[model samples]
Target: MALIPVDAALERVLEGINPLPAEEIPLHDGMGRVLASPLHALRTQPPFNASAMDGYAVRASDTLDERRDLSVIGEAAAGARFPGSMGQGQAVRIFTGAPVPDGADAVLIQENAESVSDRTIRAAKPVEHGRHIRQAGMDFHAGDLLLEQGRRLDPGALTLAASSGHARLLVHRRPRVAVLATGNELVNPGETTGQDSIVASNSYGIAAIAKEEGAEIIDLGIASDNDQHLSSLFAKARDTAADILVTLGGASVGKHDLVRGALAEAGMELSFWKVAMRPGKPLISGRMGAMHVLGLPGNPVSSLVCAELFLRPLVAHMQGARHEPDMRSAALGAPLRANDERQDYIRAVVRHTAEGMIATPFTRQDSSQLTAYATANCLIIRKPHAPAANTGDDCRILMLHR
Candidate 1:
């Protein structure tokens, strides 16, 4: 197959993808979950006219006269209302959030009133009608649209939903991803290693990226090059009902690359094999039964770069969200040589300077150098067949960190 460009490959990876089914979960558990539908207020806020401050609920006309001392008929506190209405020359001692009594349209704040005698007080200052009162449904009314569909529940959103009388929320199900690492030369971390054996570190990074993108990760451990071992893990992924199965490494056509063969035999339809991008060209995009398959390169840096470009967007798309990477322009801090058919994602450190944003790429960009990838905060994108760029040339960059 011809090598697909990065943009084309990403488009193919996301084509035909729809949001996962919605599930009803408790409101408190909705943080970071996308709402599946428009959220409506179940009940009106401040269902009745309530006092906003500690004061006396009285007729507005009665407080206009400074000479008159109104008799305090009764007291009203939160969760309690004065049963009797206040007539002329009468006031109800009302606390904050207490319901305003009948025949009362204003609250004379305690600071604006003074006790003339027992059970009697005088308004020191006049209060207008509806002053210091929260009218019914002022904040929101029942059946009012509180949140739109596809809104992510943040702290503010969650609180707003709760205050709107929603004990449970309908949210898109968090995508469950099963991650499997495959290779014969790989060993579990902290285990005994031979001269040629390396630690299996890609799965942890993949899992972290997946989780940060709102996915539930299932670690399938490490799969050897053998077909039966790989098949068992694939079966586990199917049995677990994972929405996406991410296989690390064994995607290339090399002699020892066995994942593709086993997955093909197990009925995974291939979408694409290679992308025209540096470090992450041997990417496998496919589907097996009900699960999406992404075969990432084994090199740590390449694996993470691919995850950032592909996995994050896929996860967001599955949650009914639009994934737009943070792309910005920066001046090159040093000269760069180019002219290659494959697109390059040169890791670099971006700094804000008096001149402007400056991006200085690391010297060595080997696929196996995870340290450089970890240290860099941005990826300077170089288009295919681009010419050499001099220092201070404005270039586009994808920010890895906000």
Candidate 2:
């Protein structure tokens, strides 16, 4: 098959995808979850005109003149109301969040009033009507649409939902991903192996990426470069009912690479393979029943880059959340040679400079160098068959997680 472009491959992977079913959960646990439907206010906030500060609720006409004295009739605290209405020259001591007494149109702050006696207080300053009074439905009203569908519940959103009288919320379910690592020369971390064996490390990083995208992960452990092991792992992934199945390594065409063959034998329908990109060209994608399958290269850096480019968005899409990479423009900090047929995502150190953003790519971009990938903060994008460029040339970059 012909090599597919990066954007085209991503479009194919995400075509016809829809968010999962919604489930109702407590408002407290709704944080970081996507709203499945519009949230409306169940009741008006405050429910009535209330005092916004600790003061005296008095008739506006009684406090219009300076040095005015009024008799204290009653007191109103939060969750309590003064039953009697305010008569002429009568005032009520009210606390914040307390309902305003009937016949009271203004609130004279305590700081602006002086106690003349046990029953009388004098207003030292003139008071305006409706001052320091929170009107009914000031924050929100019943049946008001406070939050729209597809919004991710942040701290502010959660507080709003709670204040709007929502004890429960409808949100999209988190996607579940099953991850497996494949290689004959690989061993688990801290395990004894032969001189030629290397420790398997791709599954951990891939799992972390999946988690950051709000996916629940199930590690299927390591699968050797044989049909039996690979088939068994695939069956386990299918039995787990995972939304997406990610396989690390064994994607390229080699004598020992058996992931593609095993997946085919396990009834996987191939979508596309061999994307036209550097360090991740051997990427494969297919479908097995209802589960989506993605085959990543064995090299650590390649696997991570592919995950960021492909898997992250897929997970977000499944959960009804928006996911877009932070792509930015920058100036090349050093000269670069021309590219070949494949596109390149060069790992680089990005820094804010007086001119603008400056991106300096590492000297070596070998896919196996995990240390270099860890140290880089961005990936400078280079298109296929591009010409040589000098320092300070314009470029685009994708910012990575620090």
Candidate 3:
């Protein structure tokens, strides 16, 4: 049977997904979380008109002469305000962040003034109105919305929230992900490997991807290739209250492919069973009650690729987070053969050239190879039935930094 297109598959998967519930968390621990609602400023910044530098606060009209001498009535430090107004020829000594005196309309830096006596000072240079003065609400005003809903909190966002008098933030809860690996010949990474068994590596990679998408993982370990074992694992995943369940391997139609059967037993509705993509053709997507499930191919490279192509977006949608799809084009470093019926996602090494980005596909195109996938920083895309491509041909590329 033919495979489904990437766009169609993505649309089907995202149709029913919904954002998780909101939770209140401390501001310090809110980084990377999506805000549930708009955040309003509770108080105005610089509650009072203040001086931005250590200097003298005086009326703008008083500094019209070459050297205007003014009597110092009182001093103002940060968090301290001068109670009375200044006279026509008088000034108040002020420090950085101190509230400007009531009658003063300008501030001159101390460098522009020289002390002449105990109560008087002389202007060393010219002065302008509003110089070195921070008016009330200069940064933000009260009742103003500083951040909108669905914004991911970053360093600047956190600082803005703190400035708005928010001790804690309201954000969407992290999506819960359950991982289940299937195969009778699979063994734990730390266990001594049997001649017929391969070490279980897919779970770790999938878990890492899930965490990067802001989802919490609950690992169900490996389930032997049997209906009983698979059923037990499915039940355990449900008990953990997982919002998305990911099953590694056993997605194709084989004697040992018990994932579909088990899902049927668990009352899951199969959405799609395959995609038009190389290495991950056996990918399966389904819904089990309120939770979504993604079945990936057994090969390590294929499994990780499927997780990136499908699972990551599902998790992001559930968290109310926005991410740009991997949509980039680059020049092919070498000639490529005509693509078959399956869409190709060949592992490649992408580098910057004087002209533009250059992508070269690895020699071995097998799905099971892991080392090549590790060294590859990009995935070169080839549509199904695509014609043969030569060097410098334009192709889509997906950059993988992690």
TM agreement with the true structure for every prediction: 0.87, 0.92, 0.91
Candidate 3 C-alpha RMSD relative to the actual structure: 2.4
Candidate 1: misplaced stretches above 4 Å?
63-68, 328-339, 350-360, 385-395
Best by TM-score: 2
**Candidate 3 weakest ten by summed lDDT:** 319-328
> Model 2 scores what on Cα lDDT?
0.93
User: Could you tell me the lDDT of residue 240 within candidate 1?
Assistant: 94
lDDT of 1: 0.93
- Backbone clashes, candidate 1: 0
Q: Can you rank all candidates by TM-score, best first? A: 2, 3, 1
lDDT agreement with native, every candidate: 0.93, 0.93, 0.89
Better of 2 and 3 by TM-score: 2
The TM-score measured for candidate 3 stands at 0.91
| 1 or 3, greater by lDDT | 1
**C-alpha lDDT of candidate 3 relative to the true structure:** 0.89
lDDT of 2 by residue, 3-103 (tens): 99999999988887899889999998987888999999999996999999999999888887777789999999999999989888999999999999999
